[model samples]
Target chain A: MQINLALAQIATKLGDVQSNLEKHLDLIEQAKARKADLLVFPELSLTGYVLQDLVATVAHKPTEDDPVFKHLLKASHDLDLVVGFVDEDSRHRFYIASAYLSGGRTLHVHHKVYLPTYGLFDEGRFFAWGDSVRSFDTRFGRVGMLICEDFWHASPPYLLWLDGADIMLFSSASPGRGLNDKEKLESARWVERVTKAYASMFTSFVAHSNRVGYEDGLLFWGGAVAYDPNGELIAQGPYFEEALTVASLDLNQLRRTRARLPLLRDERTNLVQKELDRILSK
Target chain B: MKIDLSINTNLARTILTAFIKSEITRADYSRAVINLSGGLDSALSLALTVEALGAENVLALRLPYRTSSPDSLEHAQLLVDQFKVRSETIDITPMVDPLFERDPQMSKTRKGNLMARARMIVLYDQSEVFKGLAVGTSNKTEILLGYSTQWGDSASAINPIGDLYKTQVRQLSQALGVPQPIIDKAPSADLWEGQTDEGELGFTYAEVDQLLYLLVDERYSPQECVEAGFDAKFVDVVVKRVRRSQFKRMQPPIAKLSNRTVGYDFLYLRDWGT
Candidate 1:
């Protein structure tokens, strides 16, 4: 099977859901016109990142009654959509989350497992940490979603790969920092290298959507990218600008790459779990 | 242990210009007001602001005290002409003299602070009429070393170059094509006769910038910096200055008495809904 994927690298207005929703709707139409099967937006595409106190103000449930998700769900009837937003739970605790909407219904909602609170990030202070990292089924295939910092760790992607996720969709509102590198922002260079590594190691297609724009002093470098199961660069968007980059992913590459590598088929889960249990118990 | 303070000028230029443009326009202001000191920091900032907002939208002000160096005004004019930015030469002598006159025996340090605050006052007044944001010119070196007066040159609606060290500022200034004279000359607050930043700080910017890079950016300890070939005394002084000036880099700590105090619990980005 082949899938047309759209990376919506957008600049979101901080704490303004209405304006950002309009941007999402416009991008959805553009991606649909380009014959995209799935459109992925950067993390916090609805509620902008760097919202400390405004997290609650912009938080929403994925239910159709919610104002922002309502329009996004309606748009998903045309094509599948992956969007980032602040998710509010029953106790009113918020989590940085991404939802997959297909055929006007929420298919899977992944609350970001990693809340980066260290230097230049304050997500942990405002939002509750997520406790899950599970991939779900779609019409196209079984896929997984991870927010920015979640993919930085090895375990989340490893868990998804073990759970049979053939397509890893990643999103971020990563700020541009460190000008030491000549070719790209240090953050951008690191993210690209890691995503490609995940694609190659897991033998699964990886698509990363990063936002572009400035919020307060943070500048999000929007260089969205995709790698096929063979770990070859398939698509990339421009940096520091809003863009909708579409790439054709040959899902058959998964079978081809796995047949050659056979790394995923080699079973070691029980041994790995035994050691982890022993080490963690200590 | 060697630290590379060099930055990719192209990357820096793209991000910094975008920062100035976005931060200013997001606040509903297309214009920016900068205090042109004829020094490298202000020159680089003005050049960048022009690139971000346009030569027409930037209002460069030459706020000179009577005691300020003549080269200060002349160098400032070079940038004003080079960028063709809108400019005004407002002599802050009259505004600051009243305060200086009240205390004839005031120290030069006190006078410099008064002059800085007075220039900010004029800069802010011009920003109101010109309807632009006041762009700050303080670099990371001076800010970390506590070399600037509080509420003076440090005041701005947004600062694009606050993260760049002095040496890095020169590197960026050269890349941005700021006049050679501005980059070559000794940096100064120009508060009094023959005052220089390095002379007062007791070290060159190049030396301190490297030490600061390790101590701050690389997260090296003072002992680590000393072990990294810096003089022990130099490391101590830089570390002490950075620690002492912590107050200058933060908003005043609010005493928490309620469920959510402004600075304590009510943390929101400055760009929230603006």
Candidate 2:
């Protein structure tokens, strides 16, 4: 099966939810026009980053009764949409979250586990840590979703892979500054290599999306990218600017790559679990 | 000359002592040197340094160019006379003239920056000689506007005034008993003839400082600023300056290969013990 995916490089404003929502709607139309089966947006697509204490008031709980969720559901009815937002749970503490929507309803939602706190980031002050890793069965493949800092950790992706995800979709709103262009590109390359290496081992594909624009003295450098099961970069977008990058991945390639590499077949999970348990115990 | 609040000298002394103790602990710095501009910012910084590190340990360097007003030197001399701290005057004309001879196209702004950097180089050299740290004198307003030159006036081992707005700097200067002429005169880099900071920025320091106090320190949005009766253009200019000069606030980005690289993978300050 071949799946068409599009990643949007959205120009977001800090603390301006209405303008950001309008931009999101405009970009969704653009993605639909491009004939994309799946559209992925950046992290905090609704409310921008560096919102400080305002995030506590602005964070939305995505329920069936919520207007924001209903609007998103309506948009995603015709196309598979993946977007990021600040999510509030039963505890009232918010989490940086990503939602996958299909057929006018949320297919699955994943909460970002890692809340960056140091330097310019004070995510820990705004967001509560999430425990469970989320994955869902899609028409194209078993899909896993991770927000900005989630993929940075090895545990989340490894657990998702173990949970039988064949494709991983990562959304980010990575901040940029002077001389950060090279650093941003290198980070994308690192993510591609690591995710692709895992994909090659598990016979999977990965799609990455990031935002672009200046928000609170920080620039979001968007350079969305994709990797096939063979760990090759199939598509990549421009840096320090907004763009929509599309890539078509064939599921058959996963099987062929797995057959050639045989890394997954050769895995000794029993030994790996024992080692993991030992580390956890300590 | 007018005191907004009554001066409780005992309370003032206590506050000064606490500020000094906290700053020393925060930066883990012992000795400090102030670039004595004979301006309010530098005067307040000198007082802060003396209070924080003592008069004996806080050294003052007065770098006056040939074109600098005579009053600036006299004001600086007054500070030394009152404080009884170690002092030196280095004529920057000698150092700056040679650089300008090599690069004739150097603007007055560039020349002022060269003079500032030359002063810093001298200060750093003396810092090593005196085993002291270079203390910055720029207020938050100047820093937010990128008014100070990098590796020049912006260069410091540690800064205490980086968070205080210009209005607050004035208040602090008054509280510290900085000379009246230095406090009364218009703020300038003294880069060129007839140059004033407000003239260059196209807005009064008082207005800019108030706007910044609301925007950064108080967390007011552009909309909120307008709602609070600030001019829309003034708010726009302040926001634009903050956005355009973000590079000055951040560390130079480094490419990441290691699991923890500065700016990308690593997220903590170097002094922050994990």
* Deviating ranges (above 4 Å) for candidate 2: A177-189, B1-274
TM-score of chain A of 2: 0.93
**lDDT, candidate 2, A18-63, per-residue tens:** 6677887888888888888899999988887666556666677666
| Model 1 collision count | 0
Model 2 pairs whose backbones collide = none
Q: Considering only chain B, what TM-score does candidate 2 achieve?
A: 0.88
In candidate 1, which residue pairs clash?
A: none
> Which candidate has the highest DockQ of all?
1
lDDT of 1 by residue, A49-106 (tens): 9998898889889989987888888999999999999999999989999999999999
The models' CA-based lDDT, in order, is 0.93, 0.76
TM-score of 2: 0.54
lDDT of 1 by residue, B144-253 (tens): 99889999999999999999999999999999999999999999888998999999999999999999888888898899888889999989888989999999998898
